[model samples]
Target: MYQYSPFDRQFVQLRAQQFRDQLERWERGELTDEQLLPLRLQNGWYVQRYAPMARIAVPYGEISSEQLRMLAHIAREYDRPDQALLDSAQQTQDVLQASQPGLTLAAPPLKYGYGHFTTRTNVQFNWIPLSKAADVMDLLASVGMHGIQTSGNAIRNITCEALEGIAPDGIVDTRPFAEIMRQWSTLHPEFAFLPRKFKIAFNGSEEDRAATGWYDIGVQAVKNDAGELGFAVKVGGGMGRTPIIGSVVREFLPWNQLLNYTEAVIRAYNLYGRRDNKYKARIKIIVKAEGQQFIDQIEAEYRAIVEQDGAPHTISQAELDRVQASFVVPPLAAANLPSKTDTQSKPYQRWLAQNVRAHQRPELRVVTLSFKRVGWAPGDADADTLDALAQLADTFSAGEARLTHEQNLALPWVHASDLPALYEQAKALGLVQPNIGLLTDMIACPGGDFCALANARAIPIAAALTELYQDIDEVTDLGPIDLHISGCINSCGHHHSGHIGILGVDKDGKEWYQITLGGSDGSALSGAALPGKVVGPSFSAAEVPGVVEAVLTTYRDLRTSQAEHFVDTLRRVGHDPFKAAANGARLDAGHRTRQAAETASA
Candidate 1:
């Protein structure tokens, strides 16, 4: 993890103070609500359906145990509890009112709850008060973290592989470059106000874990002809009302020129991007409208900057060394590891199969502590959970943890010998779902329940689907699946990239769901050059579960073998089969309704 320098700490502190002043001015009516809107957005504050929400960025998804503890503190102090507590007397009174007078409740009051993790690799507190926003900012800055530029028409957090430094097949450790961009882009006065929000992602590993193909500016680390390290730059990728896979702009760009090249690209977009319509203001729209001409303009601008001064294009060797040094993995003692088959516990075996991944170091492993539990929202965690995780990190994972774009936590450096103990601890914390890549492991956004912009509720649909797939054996039989749900067309859940994507929409003032099949985050890299397409007409929310089950059943019956993943099979056969399956399920549901009505009449 990159430690904050004195300058960095002071800068964050000053930003917090500025926000405090702005908040005071707004409270005093000196600044209108409209005036405070942009300011609050720049600071990652949003006026949601219920209350103000603050999104705290976790840069590159890396954090120390101390930082987790601080976040836990904020959750306890500022955020609303997930469940309201009742005193013993109140509980008894409620029971008596319910006509269950004999029922006695626990005496102790439960601890307060807090925030939820986001798919963007950040934490969001949805019920924050506007008055406490400044205090939240100060608390975050105190721990060298901030929500600056997390929202607004500026470059958002630069995301990368969660296991950046430890991926075995990675071409380069991407954290250094990600951190460099983070520092450079933070509060860049020139690009502060673009046509729309910009997102940049880098992927260093052979596996594209960061969904690079769906970002505004996506870079894949690759080796050039001379075996020199560089990036393969792709621009225009995004998802929303219009989802687009980014086009390749540069086959190879030297590592040193990354900053200059990115700056040039964004500058061109800033100059040429559409601003008249907020809906179409994204860079992807510009790319679509201009085609090759867009790339030509960017190249021309990049050349001009390069010719003007080589200084800005060059990253000093010393600076690179310093950033690289900050990410050094801690030493681990050699322990004779237990054999994989030694554990007869089915839960342990299931956990190992799902949550564990091979690490760069042979003796160490990466464990994904899943947050996708049944009945609970997929990505939510209370203050107590965060604190528990911090303790686990300190004891077993070198006091460091990484948050994943999949809305889960990653312990990046646990020894093989520590697996049993860690697994036990995780089970106690209710973090051992053993469904990392299964059907129940769905990604969903806080839809109508929290966000003001949502068309319908998303979390309930996600929960229903998760419950539908509760039989782990049946889910295992169904094989690897990526299910994603979004409240609206914003695609915050990356629904466009899931093998089975569900988008909540409003039809005649009723909630409906549109389903798409064959989407995968790795599709572009895996030779499928297109995003997922819709299967059929949007269905009512009540029909979603059966429709989804039918789609999975279609895959199971049609796939050549179990080894064929859902996306691969769907792509090979096209969406016709899944569409037919969904249609059949809908028809059956209608027939059942008619039969039930006829029986009631009789």
Candidate 2:
């Protein structure tokens, strides 16, 4: 993990104090709600459906145990909704359930005192009181963490591959470059407020684990023919109402000129990106509408920036070395020999095969702690869980953990020999679920329950599916499936990229879900990155589990063999059979609902 320099420490502390002053002013009526809106947003405070939600940035997904502990502290001390507020919220939800006939509302009661790991490698708190926001910020700054640039129509948290420095197949460690970009973009006055939120991702490996194709700007580390390091810059990729894969603006941009080239791209977008309508403000819209003209504009802007601007932002070798030094691997102590009994255990073997991954060093391993278990929302960690994770990191991972883009934590420094001990500890903490890429390891957002923009709740659907697939044998037999759920078209859960995407929708005041098939996040398993195709009309909420079961059953039956994956099987055999299976399940569920209603009446 990158150590915070004195300046970095001072900067965050000062920023926290400034926010406190701003907040105080707002409370005193010196600033109106409209006046405080942008200020609060830049500080990562959002007024959600019922309370303030705070998003804390974890740059490039690198986090230290100390930071994790601070986050835990924040969750424990401040992330609480009043009892009255909770009751009122529950009443509203109950009313909603009553309004929708035949739809089973299994959503758990509202929760707080927890942090949610987001797909962008940030942590979110849903029920933090607005009055204590400053105090939380101060605590975060004490641990070299903050919510800067986490929200607003500006460059959000810069993300990289979770296995950036440790991946066995990594070409170049993109962490140093990503950190440099993060520093440059934070509080950048020139592009503070773009037409819409812009996201950038860095992928250094041969595989796109960072989902670069779904970002506003995707920077893939590449080596030119001459063996010089550079980047393959892709722009205008995003997932929302308009899902478009990024276009390669520059096939090879010199590594030194990364900042310069990036500025040009954003500059071009800022000048022409839509502002009148929020829906079409994303860079993808401009890219889609203009096509070659957008590319030409970026190129022209780049030329001017380099030739006329003297390429002021070019990365210097000394600067690169300074940033790279912080990412040096920690010295490892000699590891204890594994116990024969532990190594022979089937549970240990299953965990090794599922949650543990190969590291660059043969003596090391990257272990993912599963947060997608039964009875909890995906990516959610309570205060106790967060504190325990910190202790685990301190014990086995050189005090560092990486927040993965898949909403999980990765112990990147776990020694190969320490796997058994770490597994035992994590299992005791309920973090050792052997389902890393299985169907139950799904990604979902805090839907209508927390987000005002959502049309329906996502947690109940996720919980139902998780319960349905609790059998590890069944899940493992199903193979690696990317099941993603979102509450709305915003795609916060990255539903557009899931192999089986479940999007919550509203139809005539009732909750419905639309199922899509064959999407990919650009992984080896998921082939080229593309949005999933919708199978049919949205189904009632009660029918979602059956609908999914039908799709998976169809997959199992039609697949060439057990070795065939769901997405591959879907592509091999057209969507007709699976679509029909889903619709049939919906019909069956409706019939069951009608029968139960009639019985009750009788």
Candidate 3:
């Protein structure tokens, strides 16, 4: 919720105009594709399988109602693919499905006119025309939003925990620091074109809701024994072709020297980080290969930056105060009133239990509006939904909402007394599913359906599972489970951190999925940050839902109590039973396919 200064506003507008000129030149053939490529990428434009995609940064996941409305406008007006293009894309998908017969793939028709909420808290548009890219950028700039540095091998958007300021167990609100870092790194000439794309995340709470361990740089706010504010800086953590937990470089870096320390870390990586191969370009590779040497190099870089460079980036207390001012809790009419949850409706009770979380202010609550539902890709919101969300934010959440890393919207300012009314409105908008961390609340990416890099379609598998798990009681009984699906090894869906991870893979030109078990995002439910282990060979698209069901069934049977979560039960008992269940389901699916084939022949 950091307010853009006059300079910030002017800068964004100029950048948008600059992009418009670049786009016009490219259209006129004045610039080659090679020339326009980096320009467009730096502006967050990417040519995907079917159309151009735009990634708009929502810094630290904070977005205003006005910005949300602008996004809704962009989705409705600009995010459209040509009819012929849509038809061709659909044909390609149909052919892919036909290639694998006897598979019950839930190939929903490709969709547009919506925005996808990403794990990094950025919003993506799948079918925006390259021609309108400039126009979209202009509109975003008008609302203090832009796609700058959202792509390319630059430091991407800085992210923080959605509950940063309001989490009961928060050590310090990391938003101000994250914002400061964002401003410094936005267009830093030295690090703009690093060896590879870099991501940074911050978490202030006792729990790791931001998945900081899965980022290039993970910063956690901490205090020294003397109670002075600082940060616990971890470097080299990332997920993709390689999954590695970040190593703690500096256990306690003074808050004032955050930027100086961050510069040291990246500067060291820039000097020695691999550039010859994109595969090993991530800082994790350098850290993994060199270990202590890498840490020592960062230390040496820090010394040089401090001693030789004079630590030019040290934060001033006044600047910190200015940034913190924007994040203060908005004055609420019901702040002094006690929460009244006397409504006895079962649905309301369920929603309260699942979607509503305790706030730092006892009179308020943090409510998560579920985007995971049947017949839609998870985290996708059409124009109408986006507009409605904006209205909801205005009416109930002090005109602000935080986009969660899990691809949902968290209204952090919802009054405890307004829960019932808010629930009713959200339900009418189809955003009131009582499934926050449940199995149905899975995270998935726009897989082969849109992403050219995907090995298989992720949407169909997510759809199949969502359709299969419509029973709320069954989902709640199964308990909190992180079921993440990724189309490829990009880890866009953060599958490596799920308790049950499904990754789309290619086998002999047909779509197959690899199932992984026992991953964690280092949250209270999921202990420690680690990638899930693959149970067995990849299963066909048809077997995924059944395979997942089989695993859940095994979990239900083996769990000592309902309180025992999926990850916990899996760890206590072991992966053999879950692995057997998954393989058995695959065998059953094969038998069904054979039976259907015989019947067709007859």
Candidate 4:
């Protein structure tokens, strides 16, 4: 469903008539909120403490059933999950009911999950205002969509593997090289102002699932040696407050010099990276201060700007067959299998054996739609369950929807007999609770309520430790937990690869936490042990799930049973009894198991 080009309809209708004449000169004050705040942040707007948020740009996490009915028509005409936005880093205090003292707490609707960080493809408008934010950018540029470069420091949103090109175990078809690096990095008039936001990913599986060692520039799609198809790249990956990964500097790279080797690795970090540290200006800290043969001789002088054929629109095999014929896929009429009555046939085959995934077309089905359900709020999801997942993507997807960088939500194709009516409309929009890939399916980030840089309050410490693991049969009876959370160190809540990690800090401001062990993502054993760091503010937020059940009761007393899970019992007991169970001392010995379950079942 990726149509639109005549240069993407004249750069989104001339950037929506130049943001409708800068929204009529910022409503007649002759345009000034710091000169229309970078022209309403290049049309994604923002000014939100309660109003004006506007986001819109869904580039790689595709969409369309007419852009999910224009985002359920802009959150049913200007949002209302109780009109939140007072710097929404997800604060609480609103819950009231005493006979509707003008009811305000979270209404059973308008939850709004489906939002991953900026790698293009957005949808965040929390209560917009400011003269109707350019009539919502002229109704998202009449549906083709806009919200250019998503945020400042340009070139974000080129992510891949939202089951890219229907992954039946992919190796290439990263949605036509993620739409030729999203049309050669949209808004590219000399890489449009860069020094911070860059992110790029491609990973055509062997199961890297596009975390591609956290990105800045990470690819993988291999083949070469005349089997043609190229790229292995991986230059200096990222995540905030220093989280490196990406290293390999091109183990293949042939396919038509993939845009002159990514414009010679972003013009060697746009003429030698680092612009006086705004958080060590990422190009992955200029490829960790230029090593690896000086960034492979600066990508061999940008692959000699693609062997002198010049870089202006280079990766063309007829523009990857006209953007892979607008992502082909669209032919699935011949239904009539509906009859899953046995309590929907064993949780629909155990939630499709943990959220489906086998499409390269064979009657499709890639699905995911998880949002880590423990005790809720892993990634919220409300607003008539996001317009009933936009009308269940027009009856069990193919009308398309995709979004996930672990925040989960993707119906890439679906058809295995409409996976039991999309698992009863995603369990009535509590979004299929299989706890995909496990560890309560986490990946926290919006730490301290509306982060202006957090220090505690990563959503009530990830909702008081998912209500201390609120017994969903003891979280699938403890299996694949990855649980992450961040408030500081800007890892946006990836709290460093979580096998069971959590971090939040600020002793003076009152609140502190840290823990790590056997972290992961993929490509078989990534990494994370960290450990050393833990302070307290009465270790608040209901003592973080009893300090993660005292590091799962010192991983069930150094596992030898319960068939080891918590990252294989924190890799066979290390880190000083999982750092004395996240530093609060064996949570008073598992709270003396509330008097030994009433003295061993009496």
| Comparing 2 and 4 on TM-score, the stronger one | 2
RMSD of each: 5.3, 1.4, 1.9, 24.8
Order the candidates by TM-score, highest first: 2, 3, 1, 4
- lDDT for 225 in candidate 2 is 82
Q: Return whichever of 3 and 4 wins on TM-score.
A: 3
lDDT of each: 0.83, 0.90, 0.90, 0.66
Question: How well does each candidate superpose onto the true structure, as a TM-score?
Answer: 0.92, 0.98, 0.98, 0.33
> Model 2 over residues 1-602: C-alpha lDDT tens digits?
78779999999999999999999999999999999999999999999999999999999999988988998898898988999998989998787667656555366777789999999999999889999998999999898899999999999999999999789889899999998998998889877989999999999998989889899999998988889999999998998888899988889988999999899988999899888999999999999999999889988998999899899999999999999998878777644644433777777888899999999999889999999967689999999999999998888888899998789899998888788888878888888889999898899999988899998888888988888888888999999999999999999999999999999888987778899999998888999889999999998778899999999999999988899999889999889999999999989998998899899999
Over 138-159, each residue of candidate 3 has an lDDT whose tens digit, in order, gives 9999999999999999999999
Candidate 3: segments with Cα more than 4 A from true spot: 103-105, 334-342
- Clash tally for model 3: 0
**What lDDT is reached at residue 360 by model 2?**
93
Candidate 1 lDDT over 386-487, as tens digits, reads 999999888778888999888899998898888888887888888988888888888999876567888866776776777777788888877788899998
Candidate 4 structure lDDT: 0.66
lDDT, candidate 4, at 365: 77
Per-residue lDDT, model 1, residue 240, is 97
Residue-level error in angstroms, candidate 1, position 181: 0.7
